[model samples]
Target: MYSEKLKYYEFFAGVGMARAGLGGDWQCLFANDSDQLKRQSYSDNWAGEAFDSRDVAEVETTDLDGVADLAWASFPCQDLSQAGSKAGIGEADGTSVTRSGAVWPFLRIIRGLAEEGRHPALLALENVVGLLSANSGNDFRSLCGALNEIGYRFGAIVADASHFVPQSRPRVFIVAIRREVSIPAALRTELPQSPWHPQTLLRAHAGLSVEDMAAWVWWSPGAPPPQKDFELEDIVDLSDDADWNSEEATQRLIGMMSELQLNRLAAAKAEARLMIGSLYLRMRPNGDDRNVQRAEIAFGATLGCLRTPKGGASRPRIIVVEGERVRTRLLTVAEAARLMGLEEDFVLPETYHECFRLIGDGVVPAVVRFLADRLLEPLAKHAKEGVFTTINGRKLA
Candidate 1:
């Protein structure tokens, strides 16, 4: 049966997180990405592989030889990310395009596939939250419009890694299925505005009203039960040989903190037992035209979003508040992997920086699994049965 064994193609396939999440039932027919380091990591973790290390813009549809049931794209978030320039999809010199503008090439490939009669049954896109507001929502609108043009109906939701792990990584996922497949009317109705159905998404695109979205589902499989017992300590590696920052370096980091941050640190220090805190250095406005580094600290059971440490300011620091003393260290690559729902058996590069970057840029496997279980698996089952189905009681067929 077509749906019994779903085959998928992955674009921007970083470290195979989406593949991991889809689990064993789904087969990845083809995977493509431009980054060699990431491809190396992908090859290391999943042996007996042939990854297409080509730029998405240059990859032709013919290169994808087989028919796939699903297509997953975790495209680069550099342009749409809040941490980077808000350069929404900028136009480049007549022909070539910028990095963020790579989404167009992705669409082009989809169109090419459709033209060749090889379009996938379902499509999934993953990216940062900033895409919703990029260019005051025009970018997202264009994206949805393109999918609509290509004979697919899509639903979007913002899933946070904290629901399944200890990190606070929140990302937006867009799931699209071919229009021919009948989706019941109940699943397409408007839902109450919440995390998954944020007001921003509803208000971002013009003509995207609740009533008009007969195909747009507010995909929520119910939130994971409150993890009151979970804590950051649960994921921390306490090996004796774990790398800890030197005393001098730790003092320097503390000294760089502003008075407000210092006060927060002092409060954590006052605790009787050791407390765990996460630190990030942000670029804040200093005066009129310049920006200054400000050390921000959060004392909570969960860590802040794990970001790629490209620069000194982007790296996240881990702080251990023990009574009156504080120890500081860079978050280990192993810890970052754990936060992203990667098992310990997952392979890593010898260089610490590369491992951290790969994890930071990749998706959380647990969140992907949640999406697959709730959205993809059910859709596959319905397709296999060749039945018109409604997610809710509302019927369309």
Candidate 2:
């Protein structure tokens, strides 16, 4: 095994959750993000590491001190998300694209690193599952093509935080290793379905076939152990004496519900035992006239996806039904943090909205750690074996 610490560069490093997932062995050589608030959180937790608060497009290879063992980026998903405008990376005129156009800068940086002979041995990127279908799979194909052009072999896996935590945060992780280190043929064979090698991803994006992917690893340690059945109560902070929403506000939300949602809420209220549920307001087509807002309530063991409160529609509201009484309130920031797989010791900014936004935008640490153990750790061992040869025909370590 390599004795020297593995260095990493984190892009779009919101709150350093990905760094946390890489664990103690990997040293972060550089970190960058555009948001001031997110950078604050990163500095608070990772004061020892070097952090650059600059836009990715503006950053150059010279700004980075050296090449890293791995480069991780969780680029913005606003443009790729289903809820947002499905702009699909924009056109030549840049009129139709969303902010996700920022992803191009990430690719530019990677290309720069490759051209300068400082490309990381491995590259990891995370984004929403919608990315698989963004632009009808062309975007994904383009991404793979870009990596392939840089002399790296890449594969992808979809990991949901629900497997490791109560939250149902599903993200797509793309891992690329330099072509010099060969991948076993047997490991590249397609499988029916797996926790790590999800069939849905393969089925959805034909561009991810074995032939298209230079090296694809399922990246699962083994069959995932059964997950614990968690309910809303398991994560809610019962100790916090927070006030419920005003009666008028609760009535207004109820007034906006559709017939189906009303029935669901009524059924939960009728139950003898106290029931906890989550609700999100969404714009839906009304009876043939216009789009109207409706409260969609889910009565299940898990909370709905946590989101940045861009508006009332994106905010998550909690519904408590105790016999004849019904109450509603905003989800506590602490609960949101727990759902994101962040530990209790992790510090949060004083502003509640910022906390919620950071957690919503952050990656699940558990999922990252799992990938590290199954992918990066093994690659480190391989690198220590001195088997990796650079594209220039130079041996690595």
Candidate 3:
């Protein structure tokens, strides 16, 4: 359900996953990425026109055709991911390491778009939940400032795929629209509130609250409510597409564990667990929004935020649910994709590791689609309508 009138340009276009999620109607005027293999994957899935394949940092604005009606950027989160080595803007070994803090370059892209008046009507950004807390929240502030400078208003929500599916993957989605849009007045009337009302994080690290860890904030007063709740079931595939050496890895992990730690893991059916979660989920601050309902804790029903390691074969304990029992295993790439609303049919690379890593590193297709339908389409409509009001002051007719 795309708005045919709008045009799109997918940046950091990983395997054309976003393009696929957004569907066929919206014209893909341009797509950019640095990986040749990923470009091939994209070419296989999308073949009408030849897209530009180059580093986003190198591509000039003049190289692209128009300003585009929408721009999708799930920029590399290596520097901003909690699951990554805590390099904190310092150079590290792995690509996922080294906090490049590249939000500034992306901001330049937006500014370029805005300059030509061909900038997208909506900008959709997705990243690990850690982005909100990394660097004492300075990274987030800079991003907000950049958007404000570009004359766009935005709202961010930290959601998990579990709400839409059954998987416990959570991520933060930021949606921005050009302030010139008029339809938000009507859209604002329909926005929904966060389920876990701005409760502070009980635990504090680098001086941040639980609420600071994950909370949806709206810069635009009239922004629409969140509609991107996904669950594991929505994106879970029934087929096995991974070659998991769980036995060896588990044995090695068990060999490395202390006697007591070994006993705890050995008692469980699954051997490997995500070690990063412990680092990420610490205790909340004292006497903050300390209201824990008798039911939420008992049922483990809180909407767990999405982690950057959702696709890692080696990290984060993977648990499988059966009739009554839950078992643990390494989550498959397909399952990870499904959790993000990216189906196997989307044509990822053949290498299991590459595909899994890439999908895990990418954004949820379903959520992206939801943004396209609910936010992007409406923004475009508002632009086309050319009227603004805090409330429904003008009729489409």
lDDT tens digits, residue span 1-397, model 3: 3334567777878777677768765778888887777788778777666777766667777877864777888777766664465334332222433434444455677787667665666787777666666666655654655676687766566555554444455666677776666444544433344532122111112243333322223422233344444333434333344343355654443444445443443344242422111101222333676732110010122223334443222332343333333333445556555555556567776665666656656666665665667656766666656653322243221
Candidate 3 overall lDDT versus native? 0.54
lDDT of 1 by residue, 1-397 (tens): 4435678898999899888998898888899889999999899988997799988878998888777768899888777787776677654231535467877888888988877666776789898888888887877877787788787888788878887888888898888887767664434445643667676666654445443365565665565546544567777755447688888988878877888899998889777676887887788887889988877889886888887664233787788887887777778777787777788899888687888778777899888998887777777556545653333322322
Question: Residue 292 lDDT in model 3?
Answer: 23
Off by over 4 Å in 1: 1-3, 91-96, 184-189, 205-215, 238-241, 311-313, 387-397
In candidate 3 the C-alpha lDDT for residue 87 amounts to 39
Candidate topping TM-score: 2
Model 2 stretches with alpha carbons more than 4 Å out: 91-97, 184-189, 197-200, 207-221, 311-313
Candidate achieving higher TM-score, 1 or 2: 2
> Per-model C-alpha lDDT, please?
0.77, 0.77, 0.54
**Per-residue lDDT of candidate 2, residues 1-397 (tens digit):** 5777788899999999998899888988889999999998998897776789888879988888776889898988777786777666664244554576667777788888787777888889898888788888877776777778777787788887887787777889888887777654433435534766565577555666455554445444455657868866778754336768887998888999988999988899789676878888888998798998888888776777787664233678888887777788888888888888788889888777888878877898888898787777677556657677665666657
Give the distance in Å from residue 152's predicted Cα in candidate 2 to where it truly belongs.
1.6
Per-model TM-score versus the true fold? 0.89, 0.91, 0.68
Could you tell me how far off, in angstroms, the CA of residue 346 lies in candidate 1 after the best superposition? 0.5
Better of 1 and 3 by lDDT: 1
Candidates in descending lDDT order: 2, 1, 3
Off by over 4 Å in 3: 1-3, 86-100, 189-192, 196-337, 387-397
